[model samples]
Target: MKAKQLYTKPAIVGLTLLSSLVLSACGQSVESDGNSNNLANIKTTTLASSNLKFSEHYLTRDVRDDVFYFVMPDRFDNGDSSNDNGSKTIPESAGGFDKTSNAHYHGGDIKGLTKRLDYLKGLGISAIWLTPILRNQAVQGDSSGYHGYWPLDFTEIDPHLGTNADLKEFIDAAHDKNMKVFFDIITNHTADVIKYQECHGDGKPLFSTSKQLCEYVSLADKAAGKGYTPFIPKGHENLKTPAWLNDPKYYHNQGDSTWQGENSIYGDFMGLDDVDTDNPEVVKGMTEIFNNIISEFKPDGFRIDTVKHVNMEFWQQFTPAIIEHAKTQGIPQFFVFGEVYSGDPQELSKFTTEGDIPSVLDFAFQYRTKDVFAYEKGTDNLNDLFSYDTLYNDHNSSADYLMNFVSNHDVGRLAYTLDQSLPEASEQEKIKRFLLSNSLMYFARGIPVLYYGDEQGFTGDGGDRGAREDMMPSLTPDYNDNNLYGTDKTTADDNFDVSHPIYKKLAEYAEVYHGHEVLRKGTQKVIEHNDEPGIFAFTRTLKDHPSYTVIYNSAKSAKKFIAANAANHKVVYGEVNQQKNEFELAPLSFVIIKTI
Candidate 1:
């Protein structure tokens, strides 16, 4: 199915640029003498903190002040080939490490990620969110568990990735640098270890299709629990760790989900078994499991997987338990965000409000700005998205903590989104639009997440398997064939080139992000957006301090005027869009100005 059909946002995939906009050179630099690197311009004012509102969520400034780097372990780097194939020896046919296929593992492990901490820290990523590293079944079917989502054992790290000690070392090293490591955890489901008697062989399920046909059955239809007879595959009885998972009663055992209605919660996700999170036993067991995980690893946070699929009641109990346990484990500000792939603010905020999760991944941000960043849609779309920010403004959670990103493992990279929107656009134009997305996220309200390969400009085919590219080097033709922004090097070559345009620009953006308190913890107010693809702006201010107006020109041509009041402003980080004045926002560029 097409991404547009799957996601609520229609403009996400294959969006065209707003009719025939010309690509002009962004005029002159708007800097003053071109020698101002005053990264820390925030006045040391105790008065600002004193006048701050008593918002529990905003008082301490936690992950809201952070910039994150999201990584997939199997695609980052392979520091040790010894752990590549898990416990399987040399003759074990590369042990699922088939570098050529996008579906197979490529040997990037915790150790590889550990070795690259400097690379991440240097780029200004305060926290690292890695895809699930918990032990997977390893090669469930044709596709291997390279992405780390298929969990056979939740208690240990997958042997193909590394050992428990290797993970501890990685976290320890990250902490030593004052950086954080957040695990991508899942309570929604385990690997597809259970099979139903009704779906086997000639028995013929009620809704069997060419791919899968375990049709979703309601308990109301069959009253005596799961509609199908679920049994473990003969030899794989004890295959799953945490042993209690062996019971069929622990799972929903309904059927395959077409991702509609009740199936979204009970149905199997792409054949992976869906756990019955609503069950009291399951809730208690999952909480204890993760608590033990925190007790053992002592990591900073969790980026929960398939969050919306679980019942709200489960999260209400689970999230607070996890946080309190983490505090007991000495991680005071342990942040947790769930993955709810919806574009609606109401849908995303519900997890934070009723479910007790601190925040959910801001798919709404990506949906609203996917076009605005590239001038395909007006910035008014952003206004529409943020207009509902108060929907997330409960006492424990608010819009400030939403994990903002334009690109991700499931939705492709930022450059990929821009390139897809404007296929005929130049690489230079693509790079500017990419930076524009970063500029908004970096200086705007929520936490900005720099997708793993985005800094190196990895624009793969589109979402999912295509979006995942190897950072180390490639043996895959699908990855090698795609175009990388700024650099000619393909995925067949090492992409750790810090000299790349996107990398260097983001590094500078990081310095600016780190130095400014307003950009981090400030109250954001969106200025009026252009009706067409023109100047998009917002203001970030902390207490009584000087407010910085952030301006972005999404137009193909330079903006002649801006709606925001930028008259008494001086460029602090970027060049002004206007040739003479600091007020005008430039085309395909962004400027941050301090009110003088």
Candidate 2:
């Protein structure tokens, strides 16, 4: 299952000849200013060009119809026990590789996920998105970087997760099943390592100095003896594995972020040293790092982390560079999406239109769906959310690429959120609401992402650690009964049950979604049903394909509706009482009908 076994290496002479011919045809030339010849620079005026054609050697994978299943490697499953405390470089205690502590590593690795490919494929997932696997700081502050956000080495995979070969095998296994794999990556900052000198009560507003602190010196005022000097630990100055990032100048050396305006973009996030993305040197350094990863690993796509914190100019240059690099390596349609973390359409659209990123996680969709279905808010809000689609660069394509989900690692679980929103509702009603919300996400426009453990009915109320609970016997032999934050509000089922009502419903609908191209890649038009309160309706249509209409009644009472178009329509999925032109929808239910 090694990568070499999966794809044969192309002859060097042939690749060079093909690249030369392709560049000549495009009226462009590749130049190497020298670090690496393969990492050539292409001069192009626009990234969006119809005239530009790549060499026939370039491979392409279209992800427009993909259904992504997001999993946190350490919290998903553990297929290997020997590597539980795997790192030889860092001590085990400092590495925090204990399963009992929720903040520490719980032994899930790539091998574990690879072993469960059948389970995932059976659930109808077309793609898998995992958090970063690069080496991370053993522990940061009071907890470990078990979530894989605090990167220590960009080039090497963490031993705790397994060797590079293990990762290659995982990807190979997934590809064998016709499933794409996406790696989550970070460029905003590294683990908290470099520090600054503490400024006393000068009323200058200094961050807490409990950890090592390096004096902050403005780049412009570093010579006057009035500026700050970074305090790098002995042997740790060159800590990042890729030698280029070892230089102190690569970091901003600024104080903690106040999260007010410009500082939010440039300052350190949660004490992690923010890279000076504006610096040409830093930009070149990161470009080399990611380019190497894409060329070596050849993942299907990337889920960019903390993209909003980086400068827009950096992305404008960086994104195109990565795409070009991938194309040179014979990968034409390498997909990429950013995490904007905003529920505002206006804010999110800027990254796609102005920043040049292809797509972004649909925070606005997640917000509205949670409000309406989980909180029992007016169903009109769902319609209102879709109305803002006009703000995107290409509304239709944007909807097709946007990553839609109910809950993720950073937020409260959907099950827990529904319970808290309607405390008096019975368990059956809560399950119904959860299923209804998921239906909207899967059937609506855009790619749907299911967070791990959500199908098993896991519930956690607070953010971060609370939401990321272990995935039952699949992840670990037994559930970690205590929540990381000790909220007592969080809860999870100890047993992994594929027969759960929600799991069964999701599997059924997944078959429908997979079989119908119109549902996967079609334009949606909302069908207004203002007279029927708590009922939402929409039609997904594509030329040359039969149109499908979807209806959802969130009301506690059954509702009836009549549509002449649906009179002779066939039931594609879901249950509804139909009689010629009239259809009766059960309480808290949904139905999918196809036009004859």
Candidate 3:
């Protein structure tokens, strides 16, 4: 089946870009350079309090203002390799994509992640988002159920990952260290393997297939006259349903492929079958699974996977129930951010305006910023990105409580996205561009999610799956079977430096942001906007407090911009150099000025 036939119209993916047109569709306000960065330049004063009252749901949560560090359990570390079980390599997988197989398992689990909690805290990250943790089907010579997406049973944690008790303990420990946990949840589909009459638990072989079981008829497919098929062996299919639904021991075996279908028209997520969310049985099952997790682990929030693939009406109906359940369980302030995967703020507004999840990932900002910094376009591009405010600024609950991220598990890393065409430039020039881009994320509004291994400067240029590589111990090469890619940076003799200068600089700025409330919660203004290309400058002000003016010299050579209004500010946050009157920004440098 093709994506156009699956869940949503295939055009929905591109619809996000269309929605961007709704913002600043007519024209925008442009403040001039006079009293630029000036705290007093604001024509009207709207006051925001450090102690602003929030709906009970957001009261105990600080996620909206903190930096989120995302980790893939299997690729991160083997805290205790004893958890390593079965063959590391799975059968029928595409061979030698990358030795590390970040997508596959490598003995990472809750224990492994917890062992490094201190390391994350040291970097000023306040939240950690871990990938799925449920049990998946096991196959011989395969990575096994390593990545944890395949759900054998929503009720139990995969023994390979650890016990339910271990999961709860990980959350408790993270909270103790002041770190929030975002548990990944998948309600869209289940594993492909199903039951067989001949299969025996004792010595009988497990059935395995790359094809998966999906309801033959979905709304998207039915519209095109695709016929329906029963998922369970209503008569005989019920008997063929995986025995794991009957017994946990059979959950790992490779089951029959006869059950699978191609629900491609629905969404881009591959392999797993799309559920008929309209079915009350399906809704109830998913909701129960969600609430049970909330009650058991008490995750600070949830990162819902493939949200748009299902009906928004379903989300409008189901998400509220999930949030309400959390409150009922005495976890009133738990957060939820869905994955809509579009670059349109207007489209995302539909999700936020609904009374369910708090916010969706801010893909709009990610796309624009990519065009802005990486491409070195004009200052107008920056203005265009911020203009989305008309739709997102005033949400039902919090204002501007969206997730702002530059890179993640699903996209190419920022370093990978940076300009690699400058072969003649020195390493310092490369590092400068990297730090400048990261600085924007560190100081910008909303939650910032740092992809796993980004701080260590992991680089990859491939699409989604190719971007998710295992974190290397060091930046050196080592010849060993354990080092799959032969890109092992852990060896002592290899000088492949993993200490990314960009991450260190960003971490330092992140600390500064933590101490300043203004940057975290303030009214942002674009002091200067130009269409000439490159140069861009802006300011953000917190009522009754000093404002910050940021200037970026985007061209290949030094450029000049007058901070005429910037001089009036009381405190300037950035460096003051020799002949301070003329603040010189190196090519691609970003400077912050405090208005007296």
lDDT of each: 0.75, 0.69, 0.55
Candidate 1 per-residue lDDT, tens place, 1-596, comes to 11110101111112111111111123423222222221112122111111212112221337776779999989999999998787663222236778999988998999999989878876777788999998886766577778888887778888888889999999988777667789999999887778887775333222232367576787676575648888776666777778888788999888788777888888888778889898899999999999999999988899999998988899999999999999888788999999998988989999999999998899989877786776478788888888898999887888888888888999877777777677766666666677778777788888888898888878888889999999998999999998777666788889876555566567656656766678877888887586688877788888878887777777766675453443555555654434334345446766676777
lDDT tens digits, residue span 1-596, model 2:
11100111122111111122111111112222222212122222211111212122113445666778999988877778777776866652235777666677878888989988777765667789999899887676567877888888988777778889999999888877777889999999888766665533323323332442333344454445555456665556667768766666787766666655666776777678789899998888888999999988988788999889999999988988997898888767778899998999889888887888888999999898888878778778888888887667562237678888998988767877876787766555566678778878899988889888777667764678777777644233224443211012223433334433344445545656666778877888888544334678888999999888888887777776576553457766655666766777767777777787
* Model 2 steric clash pairs: 195-213, 195-214, 196-213, 196-214, 196-215, 197-214, 197-215, 217-228
Writing each residue's lDDT as its tens digit, candidate 3 over 190-219 gives 654333332323233332333332323444
Best by lDDT: 1
How many backbone clashes can be found in candidate 3? 34
Q: Tell me the RMSD of model 1 versus the true structure.
A: 9.7
1 or 3: which has the higher TM-score? 1
Could you tally the backbone clashes for each prediction?
2, 8, 34
Q: How close to the true structure is residue 178 of candidate 3, measured as C-alpha lDDT? A: 66
TM-score between model 2 and native: 0.83
Residue 55 displacement (Å), model 3: 19
